[model samples]
Target: ARRVVATLSIGKRSHFATARVAMEAYAKRVGAEFVVVDSTAHASLARWNATLHSGSNSHFMKLPMLQWFLEHYDQLLFLDDDVLVSPFAPDLFSSVPCEAFGAVYEGYHKQGWHSMHARSFCSLYGLA
Candidate 1:
């Protein structure tokens, strides 16, 4: 939870109210205050494509989380749901350089696991 603690925002206090009991319990344990938000992945590839395209210019897929960041932080780490951050996670970002960062990508199709073009995205790595 150390990774999540420093990023959770308090701007949307009302929205996070419903989860207060559980959230507070979590906060007490991990020392975080997670604000709630809705996340709805689009149904079609076309929509997802458009969202990514538009996101590059304006508010991206981060949406509500982006809003929370705008209201409370300058830079926030964005972690994909599937990743498992190790105990050493917090130190991962403490030394990263500026502008560029590391990510997990489907290196050329030469390295394959079957069906199609390799899909790549960042997970567990620190984001600035």
Candidate 2:
């Protein structure tokens, strides 16, 4: 299956520099193409915004990005530009079923921020 690992990097904040090298190497090792989309680029953002409900906000770009990638590639692993992949980490896609959606649980964050947010989100959505 054709596989890609991609991220959106907006503005000039050195969005992917710190993590790109490691992630690129990991993508190579895992036989997946690595891509970094600069959302600030006119054509890139324009294309994403063309999708229904897509907006100019950088955070909202993920939906359109996922839509485009899933249409073109068999599978994609999307990551935030701030994320760093460890050299010792295993191939993340190998263990999952291709048809299933997968995500890493960040509720275990050291500061409990994600956990707290999740709880609040659950309560707000009446899922608690």
Candidate 3:
């Protein structure tokens, strides 16, 4: 049996709380384990080297926590707090190639303003 987990980083943003609730409900409906990494607490953990900043971009600690989760779960679906999972959404794990990570690509043609941001992310993470 393949064990899968849904992971999210919870920050201090008011809007994120609403998304968290929806994500939790979605996880329950899918019968998947939902893990919330409290970004506030994670930032406080010095071992992770996260700066104590109160913003949505303060996710430096997620890398370590995600690594920890990989040890236990066969697959991990990481969703941002702003992401809303529709009940009709397909099983993402089934579509992902084995031994590979998956992410939605928001291309420049789709959303121009965010293209530079996406490019920066790709460059920083060395993604193709």
Which candidate achieves the best lDDT against the true structure? 2
Q: List the residue pairs that clash in candidate 3.
A: none
Per-model TM-score versus the true fold: 0.31, 0.71, 0.60
Ranking by lDDT: 2, 3, 1
Clashes of each: 0, 0, 0
User: Model 2 clash pairs?
Assistant: none
Error of 1 at 51 (Å): 11
RMSD of each: 12.8, 10.4, 10.5
Please state the error at residue 69 of candidate 3 in Å: 1.1
| Clashing pairs in model 1, backbone N/Cα/C closer than 3 A | none
* C-alpha lDDT values of all predictions: 0.36, 0.72, 0.60
lDDT by residue (tens digit), candidate 2, 1-128 = 98999888777856356567667988999999988887545343555565535543455767766877887778899988767666677887886667988898754467867456545544643546
Least well predicted 10-residue stretch by lDDT in candidate 2:
50-59
Question: Candidate 2 lDDT (Cα, whole model)?
Answer: 0.72
Q: Model 1 over residues 1-128: C-alpha lDDT tens digits?
A: 23232223224344233323333343345343443333333221233346566665434435544444444533334433223334233333333432335455634544454222112211222211
